[model samples]
Target: MSIAINLLPPEYRPRRHQLSRRVIIALVAGGLVLLAYVAFLGEMALAARRVAWLEGQLALYAPGAQQAAASNTALGDWRQKERELEQLVQNGRRWGQMLKTINEALPADAWLTGLEEDEGKGELTLTGGSTSLGGIGDFLTNLQGTNLWSMVSLQEVKGNGQSLTFTLRAVFPGAPGDAGKAGTIERAVEGK
Candidate 1:
């Protein structure tokens, strides 16, 4: 045993602490870990909310989007039909109108024995009988004056004054190898 002596006064003495340095460091580290875990959870919640909102918006517009796609398909079908109709209108010839034109050009005394049409050659052969040669000439003149034929030529003339028979070869306006041009029915009728 040795004798002990106090060097500092009571007011200036250091107080004893319940926690050690290692324990305080461990407590601070645990608090920081807890704070990081809470932050991670908050971030996850925000992301989930955003995803739900986006899904709701997509659902709201889905019907309209589907309808618009259907409309686009229908529009394409309509355009195809319209093109087909236009092709039909352009390719089909008006025979009734052509025959009416021929009737209108025929003279009162002249009668047609045969009206032959060569579709491949696009030619018209008018075989008819007239009271006089002058009547046949008048008929040819009337046909030439119209816009129906690009070329009109007298093929043959038989018989005398009365009961004269004549054959006239006339080229359709849009026939190949002629100076005339092909056009719509309305344009041909208008002589344009």
Candidate 2:
């Protein structure tokens, strides 16, 4: 080992400048904190832009959506009316067929004066005059035998020794429930 001695005065001695471990660690930590803060600000800006874009899209489509909703309701109403009209047409056909059946069942000595219908009760009233009582019996029998009527019964009979006036009630199945109007058919008496 060799001993060395410095003879320089204190004022003339060189000074050494160096960083400590704690100071270096503090500088690195501060730099990392600043980077994280910058990243956070960038994310906030992006989120604000996304929110504005969504609002714009909503405003663009709102008017058309309202119009479509209104049209959908109108279409629904039109479809309902169409269905009701179709039902009425079907009922008309049924009524025509029933009248044709009655005409075909008439006897040569009997004639119909008037025909009335009660749709709700599904009843038909026939007023007519027959040349003889036997003619009325035959008419009732014919109406009863047909598949169209559920039941047939004589309501009244009046005879003056020359001709007979009769009222017959017949029950028809599957009548319409909605009340609109009653159908009436009238004919002049055979000779009057």
Candidate 3:
């Protein structure tokens, strides 16, 4: 044991301290700053993981998204083709009916030598010979009476006294016209 004796006035005596209050406060503050920095680093790591997870999810769905887009485009194309096919079928039906009507309207004395049809223009040209001119006139009148023939014109008439050769050109109702004449015959036929 060591014994130290201070021989001084009571006011001049030195006091021994382990740590000052200011130093304790500064240490506590420094520890708190370090702890905060560690927490910030942890939070940044968590955010990075979350971002990586989200990117993986997006990548997983990317192929499915592309397939869905391609499916939509193919569906649209199929629908367009279906519409076009339906139109073609409808046109075929109309032409068949028109041909039947023309056959029915033909006169017994008249025989057709040539018949040509232009589907794009909806025009029909017929070259026929008839022993009687009256039969040709009757055929023309019968065609005109039908709503299917929008316009009928006599193209040529040439023959000897024995028989007559005539060429006739006619436009059907569904033909393209200034009046938008398509489907007129269909409507008229349905009405009848």
Candidate 4:
């Protein structure tokens, strides 16, 4: 059996070697809290690094992204202009052929006073006067037989004794190969 004895005075005595239960528990809790705080700081640092890296990558590709957007806009504009040009060319060709067919189909005693074309609607309106009703009928028949005209309608007819005034509207189908000869006449009219 071991026996310990203290020979010093009370003021010089050594303190107890064992800690209290509450002090030990408090120390353990403080250590756990410190560890959690350190872990949180490590996570924050890693997140900051990741964010900076992503921003750098985005910066590298930003110019190419802008260029691609501009190129797409330019391509769209070019396509729109191309479509408009095609529409204009189609209208010009159709008008040339339509005028030629109308000139050929008119009767000798029928003369056109006003002619109007709506390219967008594919419509042609003709206002004319004829010496006789038979002449107007012959002109209508001739127009109906032509390949250039469709949905030919005589809207109005006014008779003043020996003279007859008529209004007619027709739809022109944009045919493919019928514009060959009419193209020459168009060029002649344009003095080209």
Candidate 5:
């Protein structure tokens, strides 16, 4: 069997060399837009990631800041407690010395029933009873003669002829004022 091939004139035939210009332009534009959109999204995602990383770092340190603040509060409270305890100890020592001084100053026959120290007011209250009035008078004389006391006032005196009770108030270390400057205690208490 013979196969017949048809040959058209060159002018009427389709030209393979000429391409669809608008279609190619549209395809290139579409590809460029898609690429640009992808690039824009990538940039946005990268910025979001950076922000998240910064937030995470801050979150990790937040607990440390809270702990430091709590520690500071605790330290401040402990310091206050320590100061209070120190004040108590100092007041106790001062009272002990006052008692010792009072005991040494008292006569053998006279006895002290109460020796009270008021730390807030910084005063000592002496309440005692003696068997003889002469002994009480002598005690007062001796106390007055000493330079260690300032404002040594005999606040009250009661007697039953044979015995006497006395209430006296004095500042320990010494009397206040310009003489608030404390000198020697042993010398004053041992005066003739």
Candidate 6:
């Protein structure tokens, strides 16, 4: 006699279906957020790798870059000094070959008390008791004829009737034989 069943309204039934759709939409949104987080982590990893690679490249080049900069500065300074020295030599004021030539022609018995070469000017002071006046005269005559010297003139002569002192001045002509040596020095200096 009491077996009747109570049923929901049609509107309530449709509300349940709507709730199902909302749950599915919420799940899909949550999945999208998780995927975005993973992608962001991957991007961070790639960015870190790029930074490390750039740092490594800098390390590899740092030493050589410093060395090249230092070398350039030193080379520039050396070049400037060489040019200045060349000008001084070319002005004919610094005769580098005068002293040796004079020494080569010195007599075995004659001893130089003062010998100097300065700015292409040569001065010599000699003291020796010659065996005879003829030997002293011959030495002076030979020095006057040498082409390596110019303005060969005697300065003063003093003798105590036995000992002799003589002073002379000459101009250094430089040596003709030193041309090849000069060129070699110039090349070696410029090679670096």
For each candidate, the alpha-carbon lDDT, in order, equals 0.81, 0.79, 0.79, 0.79, 0.70, 0.60
Model 6 bad stretches (over 4 Å): 1-62, 77-109, 120-134, 174-192
- Write the residue-wise lDDT of candidate 5 on 62-172 in tens digits: 999999999999999999999999988864445456566667778877877776766555556688988876666566666656655554555667878877788766665
Give the C-alpha lDDT of model 2.
0.79
**TM-score, structure 6 vs. true:** 0.42
lDDT by residue for model 1 over 1-192, one digit each (tens)?
Answer: 998776799778777768988999999999999999999999999999999999999999999999999999999999999999998688545778978988998989898999888867778899999988778887877887888778776777888755989888777766774564332322433331
Which RMSD does model 3 reach against the true structure?
8.3
Q: Write the per-residue lDDT of candidate 3 for residues 43-156, one digit (tens) a residue.
A: 999999999999999999999999999999999999999999998887754767777887888899887899888887878888899898787777777777788777766667
Better of 2 and 5 by lDDT: 2
Residue pairs clashing, model 1: none
Instruction: Check candidate 4 and list the clashing pairs.
Output: none
Candidate 5 structure, TM-score to reference: 0.52
Summarize candidate 6's per-residue lDDT along 71-183 as a digit string, tens digits.
99999999999999898777644334655555555666554667655543333334434444454555555665666654355555666786566665554445333233423
**Clashing pairs in model 6, backbone N/Cα/C closer than 3 A:** none
lDDT of 4 at 85: 97
Q: CA shift at 191, candidate 4, in angstroms?
A: 44
Ranking by TM-score: 4, 5, 2, 3, 1, 6
Error of 4 at 135 (Å): 3.7
Distance (Å) between predicted and true CA of 138, model 2? 0.7
Query: Least lDDT summed over 10 consecutive residues: which range in candidate 6?
Result: 177-186
RMSD of 2: 10.0
- For model 6, how big is the CA root-mean-square deviation? 13.3
Q: Could you tell me the TM-score of candidate 2?
A: 0.50
Model number with the top TM-score: 4
The prediction achieving the highest lDDT against the true structure is: 1
